[model samples]
Each structure stands twice: as structure tokens, then as C-alpha cells.
Target chain A: MDSITPNEIDIVRASSSKINEIDFENLAFGNIFTDHMLMCDFRDGKWQKPTIKPYEPFLLDPSAKVFHYGQAIFEGMKAYKDESDDVWLFRPDENFRRFNASAKRMAMPEVPEDIFLGGLHEILKIEKEWVRKGKGNTLYIRPFMIAIGTGVIAAPSTQYRFMIILSPAKSYYSGEVKVIIAEHFSRAANGGIGAAKAAGNYSAQFYPTKLANDKGFQQIIWTDDATHTKLEEAGTMNVFFRINDTLFTAPTSERILDGVTRKSIISLAEREGIDIQVRSVLVAELVEAAKNGSLKEIFGAGTAAVVNPIVGFSYQDEYFELPKIENSVALKLKDKLTNIQYKLEEDTFGWTVKI
Target chain B: MDSITPNEIDIVRASSSKINEIDFENLAFGNIFTDHMLMCDFRDGKWQKPTIKPYEPFLLDPSAKVFHYGQAIFEGMKAYKDESDDVWLFRPDENFRRFNASAKRMAMPEVPEDIFLGGLHEILKIEKEWVRKGKGNTLYIRPFMIAIGTGVIAAPSTQYRFMIILSPAKSYYSGEVKVIIAEHFSRAANGGIGAAKAAGNYSAQFYPTKLANDKGFQQIIWTDDATHTKLEEAGTMNVFFRINDTLFTAPTSERILDGVTRKSIISLAEREGIDIQVRSVLVAELVEAAKNGSLKEIFGAGTAAVVNPIVGFSYQDEYFELPKIENSVALKLKDKLTNIQYKLEEDTFGWTVKI
Candidate 1:
């Protein structure tokens, strides 16, 4: 929203640009990075001066706490280029707030707003050209913090590292998505770090997701850990269900992430006078709806995909294929949300911030 | 159990040893490492050559999956120096098996027995001097694996690194240990990564443990995530409760770790004709026992600390101080286990492996 104070961060220019050697149109999500990245360290109970230098590898001790104890958290956001080549970010304050919440939950120090938002603005200003001007083109922003202190003891780290690395992307998923409702494996506990964007939360889903992949499914719809009956999340994103034109999504809790796109869709749907209900959707109710031909659609909402529509889902060894319909609510909400993000529509909700 | 094939491992000796400048008697657990470390890489769908090089920091990309997704697992073991200058490992095969089980749960490659055990033997041979000869002295073995691939995507990495670092230690805990029974926070979830030694499971407890530390409690006795009615674990170890003369511990399940020391203690107690029961212990029953003077002792069992006795416990604003007794079942079991480990007593169970 505002210019970054030059004194707050040290800048080291890259000797050469790698932009000319790359094909931006065929880029893979989170694969290709910009020429520069942001980094800051925390030691002796305070954060050091920030730095923006050439993107490269760094050294760490073998006993860094992140390797042994998994004290790491991350936030995912995206930068958009408008028609006049002006860059914008969608609800960056939300990501910044959630980042510190994750830090506190993981027992790491909270990052100041100046370092989180100011560093983001400064880095995006330096890497503006990487944000291509197109409807689908975006520069994925990954702001993460990790425990860098060295010790094999099972305790919180005294030192940490905060970094911002940008990757150019097209889209995250490209397929007819099929998911499995988890009946055994779970992603979070009753009072766990599931609400936080902790790195551990993602890896916990990998094995289960791989199992679903082997069965021709792309992801999983995680249910309640104690009683695999209530739906919670879809893969790494917040999930939603549409039955009889009434949309239902689980409210955020200790076992569910508060996704940015998920909240925005709820707000937009309410604004457009759509029947959106926020409550726990039961597996039994979903099966009954599918059997009675009341289930219309299922989708996942997060920053990565914005809204990922599911073609079908499997529960208790029975696969239910969703009916093909026109004017899908998921695509409609995605269109409205992306229009505001790309500066193609009026910003009635005031969610986007100019970089 | 057997000598490693010389060709199977590449040894790079450290130019100098740091042993001359240290105080081993006052050593803090897992703070300092030995002169050499073992490393192996998995890429192209298989583990590469194993190497034992000087202990040092290594380079990694800022976007390494281990830093972003927490795709990591580890094991804890120890090497004991007997009276005749011989090193022996207690149930190393158990640690190796558990390590691979953790790997599979986290979607990482399973290390072959030769590399996991053979590489350990080779490294121990090189750093045998680090294993101090005393009843309390030990060379702590920390074998871990982490995702090394560079990407911000939420998926399993194709590349991984397995490493073994040795830390000489005297003991893991000191002073009286007071525990707080978990009423809100939980360590693991049902059908989750609780059974695996995944790094995430440890960090999740740091925040709650800090809260306990602030209240003058040294550790927390975690309960089941579903209801918080059943006792599960203590800090990072398996917990045990001695009511009257009967010992009880929760059985290994999807939500509890199958600890090596825990099993050893059970076996040792059974051999001594002590009443041992592997079943879930409820909080209400424990409180009732405390009121009736039947709860004799409560302790933790793990690789780092063979047995850690609790001085007192607090639950729901009420504290119960255990009565001091001369014949502690915990100490007796610990003495017997360590005696077998140090070759002071006969190894009737065939649990020790010569290095």
C-alpha cells in the first residue's frame, strides 16, 4: 500500500538476469523463481535487518531444529499485474496476520509488520517485471519462517529465519479432480496446529494423498479425526459442498485452516444473494444427498488454486460422480474473485492492495 | 552386528578432533557432536553411496521441502562402552525398523538394513572414543532423513538425505520433574503420524510445554485428542503409571508411539514377576487412585532417558504430590536395563548388538 523504507532493508543487486533464458508461458507453479529473494534472521531475541539479494542456496548446521523438530510455518499469496502493468496483491494483510499466528503456535518469535509487509512490498517492487500481464498469469509468493537453531534436544529453537521467495506460475492443478473421503487417516487433532500454516500440516497429508492417487484420485477430503464423519478439508485447502443449490462449508476450527479464498467466496456469495451456509457437513448427509441426486458440486478453496472443482469423490469404497451442470457456482465465484484480483472489475470489497 | 563392507561406505576422516577442548563430565544432552558424521542421499529412485565425513554445516536451497513442508523423520539410539573397551548397541535393529516405518508414513523412501545398520556400525567404529565408559555415559546416535528437493509446491520431494550424527551425553534430564496433564492441547491424533517419529509431532508440543514450563512444570502428560480422558504420552516419551504394585501403560496404536525403552521396561518387569498391564489408563481412574493412595509412581520411558520419574502431577487446578518411596519400581527397571546395556549383567534377552 505504501513505499518501503529503504533504510529498513539492505539490497544486493544480481549480476545478471535469468529472465531472458526462461519461457514464462509454460512455467510450472513454484518451479521458476525471480532473480532476487528476501531474507531476515532472528537471534538473541530480536530480528536482524532484512536483506534482498540474489536467489541462491544457504548453509545451515546439521542439527537445525527444523530438521529434527519441524518448527516451521509458511504463507502463500499471489501478485497480479493489471492492464496498465501495475502490480497488486490480494488481501496481503490476511496472510501477514496468519503468518505471525503460525509463528506463535510453533513457539517462534512474531515478525513485525514492517518486516512482513514492508519486505514484501520492496521485493515485489524489485521483481515487478516477473509478474506477467495476463488473466491467469501470476507470481506466487511464499513467505515462510523456519527454526534455524542447532540442537538435538526436543525444545523450541532460540533462533529463526524468515524468507520470502517468489515463483512465477500459471495454475496449480490441471485435471479432472477426484477425491477420497478419509475414513482412517487424518490431518489434524482436536487441539493441534492444524489451524496454523505449519509446515508439518502439509507433510502429514502426503502419504494419505499418495494412497488416493494410486486409486486414480488427485486429493483427499479429510474428515474429523475422532469420528471420520464430518468433512473438514480437501487436500491442503478448505473444502465446500453444494447440495440442492445451498452451499455448505465447515467453519474454521482448531482442526481447519482459515483459508483466504474460502472467506472471500463466502462474502462474495452473500453479496450476490446466494444461499451460503457455514457449518460442518456430515459424510452421511453428503452420501444421502448424492444418492437422492441433490449433490450438485464439490470444490476446494485456497490461494494456490483459488477454487478447485472436484469431478467426483469416493467414500467407503463407493465412488459418486458429480453431475455436469452449467453456470457452476465454483467457476462463477472464481471468475468474480479473479476479476477483482486482475483489476478487471470494480473493487467493491476492497481486498486488493497495490504493490 | 557385523563389520561393514569397506567398499559399501566411503570414509573421509576429519583433519582434527575436537575432543581435547571439551568437558565431557558436565555435558548437556545433544548439544555437542563427535568429529565425524555419516550421510547418504536418495535420488533417481534409490539411495546413493554412503559417506562418513567431518561434521560440518551443509548448503541447501532456500525452498528445500524440509524447510517448507516438514517432510522429515528421525530416530534416537545410543552406544554404550563396556568394561573391556567394547562398544555395544541396545536394540539398534528396533530403531532401524522404526526409522523406516516413519519414512513410509511421511512418504519417504525406506532405507535398506545395510545402509541404516551397516552405515551406523561403520561410523561408530570411527568414533568409538566418543562412547564414554560409565553407567550414565553414552554416545547418543541421531539418525534422521529430510526432504532436500527445492520447490514450494505442497508435494513429496523426490530427493532426500539420510544422516547420522553422534552426541555424547551423560543424562537427558535432571532435578525433579513435575508434569501437567493435558486438558486442551494434544500431542497426536488418531489415524495420524503419532506412531512415526516425524519431526512435526515434536514441535507441536513446544508451545504447550512452554506454557507448562511457565507454571513450574517440567513436562506435560498428553492425553487422547478425542476426549482428553485417556493418558497417552509424557513429553517425548512413553508414560507409565504404577497404582499399588501394578504398572499400566497405553498400548501402541495409531495415536501412541511404540517406544523401545518402554518395551524393554515391560520385559524387564515381567522377568522380575512385576504386574505389568498394557492398557489405556483414564484420567478419572488416575485421579481416583490418587485420592485413595493407590497411585504409587508415574514415570516416562524413552531412548534419550531410559526412565524419568515424575515428582508430582497437576490436573484441573489440583496437584497430587507422589509419596517418596525407597524401592522405586522405575529405578529398579532402569538399573536392570542399563546393566544389560553396559554388559554388567547377563544379556538373557539377546537385545544387545556388538559394534
Candidate 2:
């Protein structure tokens, strides 16, 4: 194994597959897993040869750094099966690049392109049946890294593990999501770790999200740290707002994540000649637009939900409801993106890669 | 086991101790572990009875939530053995209370007081030899909680593991420290998990601290997230300043941790009839005082260091050196706290608890 280059991946197949036991029609988003997974270890100054092994539990020391210091990062993507039983991935290179970027911000080691992309390609080919063929059914691909150093110190770990897990996912949200604009809580500060897809970033929102859930909202539109007046994101997704026919969204900054789905939507809208404005959106301006009926639509973009439409939002004890429309921007964009993902349309953008 | 109440702890002794192989004189701060550890599980909507067992590896699923979402929290404390072979702890109640407070912030179930205190008492008595005698030698105690649910969804875990591990420590810092005032990076935000001892809060500071280290600074003095003017904290410790015989420190807030050592020093200063000002220490005012020769001293307070004196600070590329004093306030406070911890002097506040 030490003699092998990073691209020369080793394979270890599981004795059997659990596919027959899984009920695809009644599947939860992330509860079911495929037979095989990809793993690589960072040791002796570099990443070793990648390996595809059986998915199993690890016998780790209780003092592993990830259990104490939270030096962990992850990426989310999806694998879809086309009508012709061909497997395709949407913009996997973007996720590959972003994963290394996240590792750098957390002071962790970067995974080489050969290892990350090559391992992902090989694993998807082995577990191709996991990718269900349907409009909304797909295999959710999770690429994650963790600090595995067996020392109970508050510092960067010298050892790490990078692994990829696949789960069958249905549509993330069943209906239009309702959100509340954060008035006091903040997600990340300027020059903070908010831009990285760190594990801690997601857990920090659970308590505040529960608060919003109790008040009848499914998510929160995080605002600026200095003043909760400018909307930044909506619970792990990048937010976009429409006033009349113009679209407005907060630009990627040190305080907001640069999502792959968000950038794809921007490119799609620009090609379609849609008026898109990527700038800081003030909460007051959004509320005013909603009151005056110019706020035509709101939606979020992410891997879990390619396009999640927002039906209403609450701010400062006042709720503003968005009217339902036929052929809305969100509906149109979701359809277009899904069609491209499933290879239903021509590969004009060349975004899909077949395994 | 299911019938046992939360207060009834079960003890499982180690087959043998590793005391003979240890070098107490050359111990690192958090590397050497004791023979036994305390662990408890949280399931079925409540904390199970605590158990003491040999320290060893844990068999965990690859998808434990703590490794992916970072739902983890911890507390730091110490145990000292007096010259008479009796062990004592300083204000363990404070740590117990704060641990649960952190749990609530991260949406984790709280560890009952009975379980926390009861387990500590039992484990300390069982591993009494690990607590070394004499000053500057002690047992560092780490009590931590982690989400153990084996799922890939971004939600709070239904299963949790709360454990306590002890390590032999020989002081944290050696010399008078040098620090740099943070101007670009923020430790946390107003509505963030900074106040809680969340694992992510500590890991987020590692990259920034490395930058300061590259510039020959031992630590960083973080400032307000909105405006880098008011001082918040220094590394893992709360900072204090003295100018013309008057002491000043920042008041605790949502962005600053409510440190046990910080509050203890404040009480000690008040009892000693020192003029202490608990308010925001602006950067402009501090710089002005340093230039006018009124800035007497600077130091940091925390459980690990007790009191660490600072010799200099750099801000905006300019350095400010503090004067060395024969009887500095930092020195006095450190002596008082350590004396009480080791049972060498009268614990006037009844802070020392015998094990």
C-alpha cells in the first residue's frame, strides 16, 4: 500500500450487499447506506493510497480530537440515475475544490484531487444500484474529514481520516418552507469560520432553529453579525429574493458560504437573461418590498434541496406571506436543474459527469 | 442497570495501574492519563446510571453525529493532593453547573448534578495516586459530552455519551507571555456559542492562533466582532489589566466566556480592598495608557494557568511593553488561588472540597 501512488486505489469488497433489505419507496433521506465506502488516512506527512472498504464501525480511542475539539469538515452532493440506467453527478469538481478549501480554513490537510475525485468515481461505479431512477430519488453523497489524533489537547491534530458515505435520499422538503429573519441571533461573524462547511457551523444552529420551529417556522434567514438587518443565508442554504422581475442575494463574503448550487443558479439565471443582483439585501428593504407586493418570490439553494421555495417570512413580530404563482421562478429553476441532473435535457453546460 | 437511579454509580476497576512507567517530573499538560474513567449514556429520554471503567478505545459508528455535526461540549478542572496525602478540588460545583449550561446551548440533554458530582468523587478516590503532591503538580480533569447517534442527518443526536478523563499536568505556561491583539479574525459572535464551552469554539481559534504564533506571539487578545476595539478574551483565558493601581477587565457577555478563574479573581480583588473596574476596556484607551506610562501590567486568568502574566502586546504592528513589578496583582492572585487549591493556606471562601 505504501508503494502505491495516490491514484492507485485499493479495493476491498464487502461480503454482501444490504440492498435487498432496503425498502426504496419508504426510505428516509439519510438512514440507509450502500454496501461499500471510500476511505483515506493522512499520516507520515501525506495522504496514503485511497481504499474502498466495507462500511463498518471504527474502534477509535475515546480521546480522538474530533470528539473533543471539533476539527471536522464535510461536503454534500448527489448522484442520480437517468432514465437509461446511466449514473450522473452534478458539478462534482466544485464540491472537490470546496472540500479542500474547507480543510485549509480549519487548519486541516488538503485531500489531493486524484484521491478525492478518483475514490468517489470508483465507489459510485461499485454501488451504482443505490442511485434510484426517478425525478426526486437519488443517492446523497457525503464526503467528510475528521481529526483522528488520539490526544486530548486543544490544538490541530496531526492525523486525520477522509471518508465518503452514500445514502439514498428523497426530496428534502415536502412543501414550501416558512422562515423567520433572525433579529438577535447571528450565524457567523466577519473573518470567522462561517464561509467553511465545518461541522460546528451546522450544530450551532440547532438550538436557535428549534426556537424558530416552536414559533411555526422551518428555518431561519441569518443576518449580519454587527446588525441583524442584512439577510445572509437560510439555515445551511444560500438565499435568493425576487422583487418584481429582479433577483437579489447576498454576495459570498467571509461571513457567508459560497454554495455550489447557489453559483449554478446564478449562472443559469444570467444565461436566461434574468435580472440578478448579487449584493447585500437589507431586511428593511425586503420587508418593504413584501408590503408593497414587489417581493414576488423567495427560495434557497443547496445540495439537499436544489431549490426550496419560501412561502412566507416573519420579522420583528410581523409576518409577510408570498402569493403562490404558476410557473414561478423557483418552480422553473428546480425543473431545469433536475432535468439536467437526470440527463433529460441536452448537456449544453457540460455540468453532468457520467460514471 | 436500567433499574438503577441516576445517583447510583457502578464501579469497574482496572486490572492494573500504569503508575510505575510514568514520569511525574517530566509530565506534559494533557497527555498522560490515569487508570480509570467515568462514563454514562443518555438514552430513552434520560441519563443512565454512571459507570467507572478502565480507560480504553470505544467502538463507534463512522457516522456518529459528533464527528459530522460537532455537537460536543467540555469542562476543565484540576485536583491537588496536599503534603499530608489528602486530595482536594477547588470549586467543582461551578464546573458541574457550567457543563449543563453548555449542553442546553447546543441542544444536548443536560447531565444531572447528581451524576456529575457523584462520579467525580468516586473516580478521584479510586485514582488518588494520580494526583501528585506539591505545588505546580496536579491532575487535570476533563468532563465532556458528545452526540453518539449513528446517523448522517444534520440534527441533534438522540444518543449521547458523557465521560470524564483525568491527566497528570505540570503547569500550562512557563514564561511571561506575549500576545497580539486580533484585528481581522473574530473568535465568536454575539448570538454564537462562545459563552458555552462548545468544542467548535476552541477549534475555530487554532488557525488564528497559529497566525499569531508565526509572528512570535504566544496568544491573541480577541476584540469585539462588530468593531475591533473592545477587548474580549485572550486565547482560552479571560484577560485583565492594571493602570496606576486600578484594575480593569471586560465584563462577561454573550460573546465572552464566563470563566471560573476570572470570577474568582474578581472576588479576591474585592475582598482585598482593591479598586477593580469591570467594564469594557477599549483598545484606544489601553493604547493611550500604555503610551503615557500608566499601563502597569497585563495578565490572563483560566483554570489551566491560574494566572499568566503578560510582558508585552502588539497591535497594528506596534508593540507595547508592560513594566515588570515585584508584587504584581497577577502574582498575588495566583499565589492566593494556588495556596487554596493545594490546601497550603486558609481557604477563606470555602472553595476547597475534600475528596
Candidate 3:
């Protein structure tokens, strides 16, 4: 491999015409791809030039370490086309920092901020056509890195592949989700990888989530491993509950992901005088709140779906159905975030990055 | 994607011409390829026909869910060629069961028993030559499954690929290892993927182990998540400690893997008149044992290396360096195990299966 200088990224333009087959209105979460993709190779102790190339398949040996050992990490963010037909990313720098944080934990090389931001900016320029304007339409950008070396010794790989894939997405998760409080299984340990958005972090939850789904619950509200008493997070999304009138959520810890949307909600809730309390919410407290009808609302926050309200929950083999209230906090937060995303409201926090 | 029968799977043979180039010696772990590879697909709620094909790369779209979600599981075992040239697999059924167990936790499809064993038999027949003779030499077989669907949703993928790749090799990890007794970091939790050979389990440990490695330790002896007091398993191996002539190991739980080699050594130790204790060994207790000079030997048992003796261990800030003995249990167990593996001893235990 030839050494690639910073200025010589070799960003070849897309030769093929833009995608015209798929109707954007019916797009799912991560099915459609943009015309261009961003890539950078990590080898010989440094990251190479960030390249923007036409989206295509890259070659990999069957024995690639990532295929076997799962040395991989990823970040999920979206690019939205405003009503005035301009591209924007919501807190792109935060996404970049979180991506590297996940990389450090996964034992994969971290992408330099300059390289990460540069590649996303360059790719956004080329793949701007993929970003749609209407409500619930956006270009979902997935930034991921994988250990790509051919040698597999049940150890970490030497080389890696960093690539950004673009997908047109509507709702990341489907419908209003009902979750079960975990009494037997925990999502992460106090010293585990729950905070990072590594690919393996999600895969390990599939089985437990499936079991919960089989019991008619759509998700799991995972608690701490030492004691399954304090609520940490939903398997993917960060969860918040309304106890009486104060909005309460678990504080970010090693076992809980520091969600962008979760942070946004804290700021928005404070601005809206919602009396938000970012602290541990014990299951016993939740159960008590439920018994006294003080559990006003339960919601999940993430980039995919801004804020999704929970309808019900199960605990200790018993299910509790939640009442859907009009003008809920979830709906209000979703509107606020989406409005800022679509340039319908002034982004006072400067959360949106114009492309 | 046509329906495949058992006989059709057997019909595909290893290419006779290419078999000559394979060298049993000078083989790196997972670096040498066998003539034929074994494969089965999980779709529509069943594990369909097992096939044997020439070792080659198969195509997958870049958007395959496995690449994004890390929904993959794998197993490692070996096929030994005895002095009489008879092929043998050491407890392959155990590997199959573990593979499926990992699949269940990862939410990947379960592979049928008949197909799994049938595929192994067919692949071994074609690539029999890859199985080497002499002690510590055999065909290292890796059976793995990965979700292969082309969508990036955070849920389970509908499709999966179950495959077995063979590698000619010596020991996978070569060393008289040194490990750090974990104080702050942990590998698995109370309700985690530690019991399963899920890819995430391995990926989650890389960063923590790297930190330990930087401190001159070869591995980290992982502790239970609830309390960092008890010793669990080592990275890629199950551990055993000899304190005051009593063999002690942690009992297998939801947080510890049911390692095949660990079980084998336990059985072998009992047959050889070694006092064994299957119970938890707390860090403070072990440190005390080291202080009183009761910590005689520390060894790790796994299929890859058979027995790897630990030369030292580090706690919070204290370091315990073990002295080398003339003939320890580690060497004796390794010799006995490898002797049976090379067909130098009577197969009284019925652990070896002839193919």
C-alpha cells in the first residue's frame, strides 16, 4: 500500500447516476444507501487519508479477524435536508467524539477528529442528494470500523477498515414500544462496554430482547448487574420516566450509554421548566409510582427515533399497561428536536451543523 | 439457493490437485486452509442441508447485518491424525452443542445436530490430509455462524451463515503466560454473554486486556461482575490454581464459560489422584495464599494450548511471580492430554472419536 498524505485523499467522484428507483416516502431504517461513502485505512500506527468514494463493495479475506473475533465499533447519526433544501447534521462533533470513545474501548484504532470530521464533511457534500426534506425523512449515516487483517489468532487484528455508510431512514424503531423490566438479566456490568456504541454491545442483547418480545414486550429496561434495582437504559435507547411531576432518568455510567438525545432532553426539559432529574430511578420507586398512578409517562430517546413513548411494562411476571396521555412529554421533545433538525426552529444550543 | 440433500453435500469433494501444496508443519493458527469448507444456512426456521465446498471466499453485500450488528457465533476444535493415519475429533459433539448455545444467546438461528455433525464428517473426509500427526499438531477447525441479511436494523437478522474453516497449526497462543488479577475492570456480568462463545464476549474484553498487556501482563484473569473478588476464567482459557496441593477452580456459572478443556482437566486430575476443589477463589484469599506460599501453581487450560502455566500475576499494586517447578501438574496434564491426542495412549476415556 502506498502512503497517502493528508492532501492526497484521492476522492474519486461518483460515476453512476443518483439512485432513482426507490421511493423515499416508504424507506425503512437502514435499507437505502447514498451514492458515495467515506473511508479511511488504519495501518502501521496511523490513519491514512480520509477518502470519499462511490459506494461499492470492498474486498475482504474470509479469514478477516473482524468476521471471527468481532473487533468492530460504530456510531449512528443522521443528515437531514431542511425545508429550504439544505443539508444539516445534528451535533456531528458529539457523534465523532463518541465514535472514537467507542473505538478506544473496542481496542480498535480511533479515527482522528480532523480525519473523522473531514471525511463526514466531504462525504456529506457528495451524498447530499440522499438527504430528503419532508418530515421523518433523513440520511442515516453509519460510521463503523472493523479489524480487517487476514490473520485470526483469537486475538486482536493488526489492520482495520473505517467506512461510513449512508442509508435513508424513517423510524429507527417501529411503533410505540412496550418494555419489560429485567429481573434476571442485565444489559451491562458496572465496568463493562455499555457506554460504547460498539457493534458487539448490541448483538449480545438480541437473545434477551427476543425473550422479552416473546412475552409481548418490545424491549428491555436493563438495570445494573450488581443489583437489578436501578434502571440503567433500554437495550438501545436511553429511557426516562416521569415520577409524579419530575422527569427522572438514570445518570450516565460505564454501564449506560451517554445518549445524545438523552442529553438534549435534559437541556430541553430544563428550558421548558419540566423539573428534570438526571439520577438513578430504582425499580421499586417505579413500581411504587405505578401503584399510586404517579408514573405519568415513560419514554425512550435516541437519534433514530427522537423520543418514543412507552405504552406499558412488565415486572416480576406481571404486566402493567400504561395510559397514553394527550400532549405527552415524549411528543413535545420529539417536536422540539425535529423542529431544530428541519430548521423550523432556531437552534439556540447550536446543535445543528449546516452543510 | 436451492434445496440441498445430505448426499449432495457429501458429493462435493476436496480438489485432489491442490491438496499437495498444504504443509502440516510451518502452519500458523487459522492461517492454513483445508481443501474443503463446511457450510449450512439457517432460514425459514430450520438449518438446511450441510455442504462441503472448496475453500473459497463467498460474496456478501456490504450492508450484511453481520457486518453492522455483530450477530455472529463460532467454535474452535481440532481433528487429529493418529500414527495409524486414522482421523479423530476430540469431543466434537460438545463443540456443536456449545455453538448452538452461543447461537441461542446471540439470537442467530440454531444449527441442526444432524446437519452440524454431517457437515463436519463430510468436510473432514475431503480435508483429511490437513490433519497432521505427532503431538501438538492437528487440523484446527473453526465452525462459525454469522447473520447474513442485508439490512442494518438493530434487531435480529432473519438469515445466517454457519461455516467451518480448517487451519493447519501448532498451538494457537504460544507462551508461558502472565495475567493480571482484575481489580477495577471486568469481562462478564451477572446477566451477560460470558457463558456463551458469543463474538461480543471476546470483543468486549479486547480493550481491557490491552490495558493489562500494556502493563506487561499477557492476559487478565476476569472476575465476576457483581464483585471483583472471585476469579472466573482467563482470556481464551479457563484457569486452575494449585494452592497447598489442592486444585481449585471456580464453579461454572452464568458468568463463566463451560470450557471443554477445563472439564477435561478436571476429569483427568481426578483420575490421576489430584485433589480438586470446584469453588470460588476470592482475590484477597488468593493474595493471602501467595503470601503464605500456598500458591504453588497457576495454569490455564484450553483446546488451543492444552495447558499454559502462568509465571506471575498482579493485583491492585502487588505482584506475585511464580517460581518454576521441576514437573508441575501443568506439564503432566499437557503430556497426558497430548499423548491421548496423538494416539500414544489407550483411549480408555472414550474422549477421542475416530472418523
Using TM-score as the measure, which candidate wins? Answer: 1
Q: What TM-score would every model get versus the actual structure?
A: 0.99, 0.97, 0.95
**Best by the DockQ measure:** 1
Best prediction by lDDT? 1
After superposition, the stretches of candidate 2 with alpha carbons farther than 4 Å from their true spots are A1-7, B1-7
Q: Candidate 3 chain B: worst 10 consecutive residues by lDDT? A: B1-10
Candidate 1 lDDT tens digits, B269-295:
999999999999999999999999999
Report the C-alpha lDDT of model 1 over A30-132, residue by residue, as the tens digit: 8888999999999999999999999999999999999999999999999999999999999999999999999899999999998899999999999999999
Ranking by TM-score: 1, 2, 3
**Model 2 shows how many backbone clashes?**
0
lDDT for each of the candidates? 0.93, 0.88, 0.82
Chain A TM-scores in order: 0.99, 0.97, 0.95
Q: Give the DockQ-based CAPRI class for model 1.
A: high
Clash list (residue pairs), candidate 1:
none
Cα lDDT tens digits, model 3, A99-131, are: 989888888887876667767777777778888
Worst 10 residues of 2 chain B by lDDT: B1-10
Please list all clashing residue pairs in model 3, or write none if there are none.
Answer: none
With a 3 Å backbone cut-off (N, CA, C), the pairs that clash in candidate 2 are none
